[model samples]
Target: MMNNKISVREVLVEDAKALLQIIPIIDKETEFTLRGEGEFRLSLHEEESFIRNILAEPRSVMFVASCNDNIVGSLGFRGNNLTRYKHTGEFGMGILKQYWGQGIGTMLIEHLLSWSEAHDIRKINLKVVETNIRAIKLYERFGFEIEGVQKNEVKIADQYYNLLSMGKFI
Candidate 1:
């Protein structure tokens, strides 16, 4: 019952509106999490600039998942800047709240994996909040391992949280 009708494609500058819908989803989801406390608020202008930066970089790529003409998720990978780590790329992803748990995140990660291989990105890494078990498990299923914990890393709402760094080799 899987449908390829849900399309994943490179994100374009014109997709601002479609992608904007997911920002609130991210905000609300992370609001209760350690990163969303009173600090690190997401801004439309910042996100817009981020999209442009990723698109402008030569060794970076961004992708969006769309269904029935609406974007439901987005992901990206940026090549490591240091020459010694050039084969490695950092990655991240987010899905609209309504579309989560329906395999959108899974498919998005899978698609990114293939894209990484094609672009010679040999490794991918990201950091997740230690309390987010679901996301940690999802990354585990994709062959990512817990690299380490960043102690007292993020201060959210008057509390501190650890960031569990995770990574995978393509």
Candidate 2:
């Protein structure tokens, strides 16, 4: 989806280097994810290896949103490897806090859902901090429903928070 000069597309292996550089920054700048600042510590080689694995997976995808060639956001899905769970997938996404509320989140989810449907994935699952009301609302807008809550699943700083388990079936 394109609006206000933001572009989204599948990430390529060559993007691993740039992605590795920016991922930690994004993690550090966002409080809505499982990882806190500087928690996503990975060597360049490790990140490259990880990206290669994601690229090699037949039922997984990583999409990035960019503005002027700088990566601003990412959304991804990983399908289950087990034969019995092959029809299911899990997703994760994050946008640079500075770029929030520009409709980028909606575009990412839309892209993933369309890709999931085309890939024949029947179910998609995700988890969000219960306090992340904006993300919860966005997911709900796209048909995701809360299935359960893991009480006190995340502890940030001096406080604990619940994690909302959400899913959507195509």
Candidate 3:
């Protein structure tokens, strides 16, 4: 059982250390994400700089979910700087394994959709490993549709997994 309430909010520079700490843990817990165990190696200063950059970018935003002020999950949207593609962006998210099935991902997506609409974002897209049915279902519940598939896109554990491209129009 969870010991505290879960909340989602815009990420802050102060979250750099906690964010950095949780990311590799989540990576080790799941294969759905692109990164694997021991693959995330961002220094504290670099993480702080990254949060600052995201905060300064008009077309990009990042949010983190906390349980009792402990960062447990994160969601981020990366929009294009080019005027022609500024209305569209791709998002990626991750949550700690223990928090799964507790509506944390849903909370993050709701927050992202609300923020995207206010920021004039017309479309959002994401790519997921084909074997990740749980994530695919979550995205589909939020109105994302599979637009295409990239065969043999990611090779993990000596096996290749297809990547599904999904998008939603706001």
TM-score sort, best first:
3, 2, 1
lDDT of 1 at 96: 66
For candidate 1, the TM-score is: 0.83
lDDT by residue for model 2 (1-170), tens: 23458888998777777787777878888788768887887877887787788889989988998876778889988999898999999999988888898888988988998998898899999999998999999999999999999999999889989999999999
RMSD of each: 3.1, 2.0, 0.9
lDDT of 3: 0.94
lDDT by residue (48-149, candidate 3, tens digit) is: 999999999998999999988788999999988788998999999999998899899999999999999999999999999999999999999999999999
Please give the range of 10 consecutive residues that has the lowest summed lDDT in model 1.
Answer: 31-40
Local error of candidate 1 at residue 74 (angstroms): 0.9
Better structure of 1 and 3 per lDDT: 3
Best by TM-score: 3
Per-residue error for 21 in candidate 3, Å, reads: 0.7
| lDDT-better candidate, 2 vs 3 | 3
| Stretches of candidate 2 exceeding 4 Å from the true structure | 1-4
